[model samples]
Target chain A: MTRAKKTWPALVALVALVLAACGGNGATETPETPETQAPETTAEPFVFGMILVGPQDDRGWSQAHFEGGKYVEEKMGAQMIVIDKVNPADRPDTSVEQVVDQMVEQGAQLIFATSDDMKDGILAAAKAYPDVPMIWSSGDSAWDIGKAYAGLPNLGNIMGQMEYGKMMAGCAAALKTETGSIGYLGPLINDETRRLTNSAYLGARYCYENYRGLNPDDLTFSVNWIGFWFNIPGVTLDPTQVTNDFFDGGADVVISGIDTTEALVRAGQRSAAGEKVWAVPYDYRGACAEAPEVCLGVPYFNWGPSYLEVARSVADGTFEATFQWVGPDWSDINNPDTSAIGFEFGEGLGDARADLEDFIAGLASGEIDLWVGPLNYQDGTPFLAAGEKATDLQIWYMPQLLEGMIGASSAE
Target chain B: MKRALRAVPAVWSVLAALVVSVGLLALAGAPPFEALVLVLDGAVGDGGRMADTLMSWVPLTLASAGLVVTFVAGLWNIGVEGQVIAGAIGATWAARTIPGDGLVVIPAALAVGVVAGAVWALAAGVLKTRGGVNEIFGGLGLGFVAQSVATYLIIGPWKRAGIASTSGTEPFREEVWLPTVGGTRLSPVAVLLAVAVIFLVWALLRGTRFGLRLKAVGANPASARLLGVPTEATVLRAFALGGGLAGLAGAVLATGIQHKLVPAIAGGRGFLAILVVLLAAYRIVWVAPIALFFAILSVGSAQLQLRLDLDSSIGGVLQGILVLFVILIGGWQALYRRGEP
Candidate 1:
């Protein structure tokens, strides 16, 4: 028995010794390749890495980013290596820095970390791999005044002017709502989401007053923040519940700000159950198709142009870190030809298309300013002085819901 | 001769698992040897990476060390994950509500966490003893409830302003933040506490009469009861003690690493602790080292995807294979013993 016990301890010791030796040997032998390489003037395909927090085909935020990646792949003939469903919640064992290291080791000269939550991870990796160009999506952390901003020479931030798209969606929702009630299905109440929701409310109010010939005061716009980008059951209120609650509370139009098709799907089901409900979906181009019968339209992001531009710059050795927030092309706001923010009207909209188009034209001509002075925050505090147009910085950090909206600006 | 013979099967099983993993890696279009090298390098390649591994190891060791006690008492504390979550929730509540600095806040939060976790586990124990429910089912159900409760709190009353996020509660006040060693994630005090708990558990199981009585109940409860042992009390005590340790791990996770109560704060480490206990063959002495090894594997294998273009799932696959091999070898030994007797 004594011999057996002694031998077991020795065997464990040997295993430990072997593991330590392997680890030590690996540290010495592994080459520390520079993450960034100078752009070569060859026709060789540039390998780039794209990291996504959710599945590529989630049909929401992640799907849009994946489509952007695909666009770069097709246009530039670049080799695309993607790692999807990389949520900190689901995979706590892995760090974003480690994933970036993996991408660097695989010879990716540039990487796109495409989630707001991935900002810290991407920043850490940017510092670790100083040569590799890192681009983060929907984040201003690389900007000069951003809260988490760092002056990393190799890091940049890019996001579309989605507020305008959201405004258009709000217009469509207002034109379709017979009850003068619009439900904004908001996903978390960050500055980004708050700004988008406020933009949508402004558009809805504008359309209701001008086209619908209704008192804007009578038009009710209520927002319910779901506390996350998507429903996590008991962790966050189910988007389905919020959607249904909106409809149950007499909202004829439910506008989704989340990353899923739940709003449209639920609206479609309610519509089929003999209710006259309308829905607007966000993110991907095909989101309206999830419930086309109830779909009003989609304000989708065309990430292709932005991603293509960044990749081409890197390939041409002209890449510089900048916070780029591209807006819609005025002449062709919904044009696949020019705009980063495109609005696709769904089949559910009956006879409101021409009016919607006129509204868009007015927006493009700058004849109707949504940021005009007379706006008060939800707390009844003046948000914009008379004749004052909101600056990009002001819009980016919008802190409260505007007047004429009913809902908590912050979660309870 | 018998010990040598037993070791052979375990060694063969492990080799078999490795060979299988290598084949799987090849199928995934990665060079197996290179991938292995990347994992090794990523895990302990430098001081920073080793610290990261240790950061993960501390909480895991604490939880698994607790599991060793539960497993020794023949209890499957599947609810340890829930206990961990409950602990975090309790700690987060205290951290948010209690007004103080790190010294005062940390201890108070951890104390609540221990009590909450113990109570949560004891509910499962009570169900088993009083309501004729299996601990596995009861514990699993309670775990789901605990998660739901956490989710509700995070998204509702406890949510951060201007952004109710799954990102978790807004970070605790800086003054209340656990002290770290040199800006690394490793909390020196947390590490010392974990080591202390491990030693305490080791002493409790190895040198105490209570430990012997618990073992007697676990070995043959009916016989132990007939011999005047208080089976129910011993079982309940084991559950509470195990739960308290798991809770402390949760508090450490919240106060040390996460700094906020994320929905995935436990990060499935509760279940991972079960695997650690099994790998150590339910021996308390082996739990810490084995937990450290698993932590290294998890932290290091994260690099495989970057280096070899392999999936991060490979880490999970490797852990699963090891557990499967160990269990198979154990089962084989048990069958051999039955045949010999």
Candidate 2:
């Protein structure tokens, strides 16, 4: 028995050695063949690679980016390679840098790292591969503001004027809310999140006072930050619970700032259950289709034009890395033909459809200014002097909740 | 000769698994040989990648070492995952609430994590012993409870300001950040702690009377009772010891690697540790190397996606095949021994 036991260890060692030898042989033979597979066709079309933080069909954040890639593919004739669902939480073993490296090896000249969570990874890849131009979505790393920000020559950041979208969403909520209460289903507190929430609140308050002719003091705009972009059971608050809490707490309208359609879907269910609840979903154009019965409208991003412009500039060798925060074209704010921000009205808007359109027209014509304020922050600090309009920088770094909004600015 | 004869089946089983995996790659329309090369290259191609592999290896090895104790005691502590999260929760609480320098904060947080993990595991132990519940079911259920508690804290009380987010507590003060080696994932102190844990576990299992008595209880409870061995106390002790180590792993993961809590802070490492223990054949001596191998497979598989455009699930497939083969070979060996007798 002792001899047999000893023999097994030896046999195990032999097997390991043999396996290693086979693997070594395979490794040595691989590099040569892949290089030959590259097509000799005239300066291979700028292979633009995109890394999405969630699934392409998620119908929210990631889907918007995926559609942008498809747009570039169709309009610019760019070769697009997109890898979706690249979340750090899901793939702990893989890093963003490693994914970028793979894309670079696959002949991608330009890479778009989509999702705010990808900031660090995108920056690292930009530093590692200076020759490849990279664009990071919803990042401010390229801006010359903080010491942490770097001016990478090949790295640029692109984000839409989503505050405007949130503002419109807020207006829609205000026009639809029967209980004079609006619930903002927020995701994680950041400058971006706070600004969006505040914008929505401002929009809701504007319409409540001006359009609906209701006392602004009688309106309640509350935000419940679910602590993440989406529900991750046990690590973040369940969106359904937050939605239920909002509705149960007497909010008639819930505006979603999250990547998923939980708020809209939950509102739809509540409506089916005979509760008069309406929702405004954010991100993708098709988000309202999830539950048109309760979705008042959706404030969606039109990333196609912006993405195509960048890709074309790169292809023509006229690309300059810059922080681009594109806003809607005022002439046609909801024009799918030209505008970067488009508001699609859902079927849930019973009689508020025309009113909502009038509000949008007023907003586009500079007849409405949401930021014109003597606004106080959550701490009752003066956020804006009387009649002072916030600049892009001021709005981007919004510090706290606006006055009269009920919820903790920071986690308790 | 006997050892070699015994190893023969395991070697054959491994070879068979590899053959099966190659066939799978072919079915998926990938060049199996090239894919193998890419995995190896990605795993160990450079210093940075090696650091990442070792970074993953630490927590996995620590968790698997803990699992070995429970397996030896014949308890399926599937709640190890929850224990790890509980440990992270304890550690994050300390890091966030405690006002101290790294020296004071690191040890204090880690200690709390260990205690929290032990306490959590003890619940499963109590359920098994007193409530007549199977440890697997009890552990699994408790694991879910632990996850909910973590989520609640993150979203409710511990959430970062201006944005309650799954991003976890605004990263612990930089002063308390685990001292890493020049920005690489490798933390000297964390690695040393893991090695120290492995040694301690090994010594406990192989070089002590407690180990022998526990083995006796596991081998035959009735025989152990006849021999005046306190089986229940030994089993409970095993659960605590194993839980303590898993908690320490959670502390290391939180303070060392992640630097902040995410919902996926444990990242299924606790569950993966079960596979590590299995690959080591439940032997404490074999746990570290086996864990490292799995880490390599994990770290290297990213290249499969990059180089060959193969799905990352291929790595999971390879790991599953390896474990399946080992179990099959082990069963075959057992049957052979019975036949010979």
Highest DockQ against the true fold, candidate = 1
Q: Residue by residue across A312-380, what tens digits does model 2's lDDT show?
A: 888888887888888998887666546778888899987998888888888888898888779999889
Could you give candidate 2's per-residue lDDT for residues B1-341 as a string of tens digits? 96566445445656877899889888778899888777777777777677788888888888888888988877778788888888888888888889979999999988988888888888999999999899878887888888778777766687665555566666677777778786466788878988998898888889898888778877777899799989889889988988888888888888877766666777777777875675565677678877787788878876665566565456766766775676567557755765685
TM-scores of all predicted structures = 0.80, 0.81
The models' CA-based lDDT, in order, is: 0.79, 0.79
In model 1, state the lDDT of residue A367: 89
lDDT of 2: 0.79
Docking class of 2: acceptable
- Poorest stretch of ten by lDDT in candidate 1 chain A: A21-30
Per-residue accuracy of model 1 over A1-412 as CA lDDT, tens digit each: 3433443444344334323322311221212222322234477788889898765666788889878888887777786777665764546666677667667766888999998767556876898788999899898877887665788889999999998888889999999999989999988778889889999999998898889998989999999988778765446679999999999999999999998889999999999999999999999889988889889989998888888899999988999888989888888766653678888888888799888888888888988779888789999999988888888888888888898799877766
Candidate 2 at B185: error in angstroms? 3.8
Evaluated at residue B150, the lDDT of candidate 2 is 78
